[model samples]
Target: MRKVLWIILGCTIASIGVLILRHSHVVTGGTAGLSLSLSYALPLSFAVIFFLINIPFYLFSFFQMGWKFTATTIGSVSLLSLLTSLDHLLPSFTLPSLMGAVTGGLIAGLGLSILFMNGASLGGANILALFAQRKFGWDPGKVNFSFDFLVVLSSMYSIGFSKGIFSVMSIAITGFVISYFKQKIALHNQPTPASVTQPLDNAISK
Candidate 1:
């Protein structure tokens, strides 16, 4: 129950960041950014594009991470899509480029870290990152960053060089934040060392 709420919260936070970037005409990395880029050129909306792009990754998540993870990811992605789709209801304003990148990237990164902590993801590169982290001990954040960088770079033709550069910085900040969270989660789950003579000490006390 608590976990579900946390996932919802994460989704909301991520949606807000997406909204920020969208209005700023900036995009982050991953399929989220990819969808955003596509939305700029296509007549479709970001929500629709994002959900569609993630469909294939759901299969990847199910096969690599398991049904439970895949289910949670689907839900999270849906919730985020729904939330961001509501952008039409709000007053519109664009933030300065650097401000939007830094702010949106950080918020989205923290939200994503929470989701990853709870075994959920936004799919696409996120699924790959988590799978590699669990299966091969790769750093999920770095792997994620690499994937994001490529996707964002590819979108440069649409978003232009200046926005693409800012997008890179945003994803870099996001990746660093995610790496920090992964390290902290790793340390938190490490077993504490027991005294070597604890059995003898217990026997003496008894």
Candidate 2:
């Protein structure tokens, strides 16, 4: 129940943050950025673009991250898509580029953190990052940042150079936020020493 609540909150927050970025005419990274970029060129909505882009990654997560993670992620992504669509029904307003960058970054960071901590994800590069962290001992946050960097660079053509720069600011802040929590979670999950988990007698004998 707690996990479900957290995942829902995460999706809501993420969808709002993405909407803010879109309305500001800016972009971020990962599948979100890709979806945003494509949405600008294509007539399709961001929700549809986002959901479609993540389909391939869903398969990756299912095979590498297991069914439970993939299932939760699929649910999270689907809900986020639905929530972001609601933005169209609301009073339309555009945030300034700078304000959108900072605010969206913070909100996205928080939402991504919540989703990750709860064992859910937005798929795409997120799935790859987590897999690398577990299987290769890499820093998931840095991996995410690297992927986001490439995505932003590739998307500069679509969003224009100036907006891409702002997008960089957004992703950088989001990366920092994710790295902070990733470190804490990694430390928390480290193996406990025998002396800590074992009885004194057992420890001394061992």
Candidate 3:
């Protein structure tokens, strides 16, 4: 219950970040970035592109991460798609390119961190990142950054070079946040030597 709410909140925050980037005519990386780039060329909405692009990744998630995680990711992605589409209904505004880049990246980083902690994701490269981590112990951040570079590079054609550069900055900030927090969480989950010994000592005393 609590976890579900956290996931929803995370998705909402990340969607808002994407909305900000869209309004500023900037892009990020990952599957969402690919969807944004496509939306520029096609008449489709970002929501439609995002949802469709993620469909194939669900199979990877299900096979590698299990049904529960896959279902949760589906829910998160769907919610983000709906929210991003509905952003059209919100009052229109704009931000300076640099500000938009930094703000969007920070907000997205925080949101994605929350989703990851809750065992949900926005799919696409996220699925691959997790799979690589599980199978080969590759850092998810590095995997995501590699995919992000390709997606953002492709966006240069749609969004132009200047915006693409900003997009890179945004994703770099986001990836750093994800990596830093993920590592910290991993360390926190490890049993300290004192903690291990304390339990054994307690058992011996009993």
Alpha-carbon deviation at 126 in model 2, angstroms = 0.8
* lDDT of every predicted structure (CA atoms): 0.80, 0.79, 0.77
> Global lDDT for candidate 1?
0.80
Candidate 3, 78-190: lDDT as tens digits: 78878887986889888888988888888887788777766678899877766665567667677877898899999898778999899888888788777866653233223
Lowest lDDT 10-residue stretch of candidate 3: 197-206
Q: Which of 1 and 2 is the better model by lDDT?
A: 1
| Residue 122 local lDDT, model 3 | 84
Q: Which ten residues in a row have the lowest lDDT in candidate 2?
A: 197-206
lDDT of 2 by residue, 1-206 (tens): 86688789889988878888878877768987777778888999987987788888888888888898999998987898789878869897889999999999888877887787666888898888777767776777788888899889989987789999999998888888878778543432234474455332232233
TM-score for each of the candidates: 0.84, 0.83, 0.82
Runs of candidate 1 with Cα error greater than 4 angstroms are 38-52, 184-206
**Which residue pairs clash in candidate 3?**
none
Candidate 3: count of backbone clashes, pairs at least 3 residues apart or interchain: 0
Pitting candidate 1 against candidate 3, the one with the higher lDDT is 1
How does candidate 2 score on lDDT? Answer: 0.79
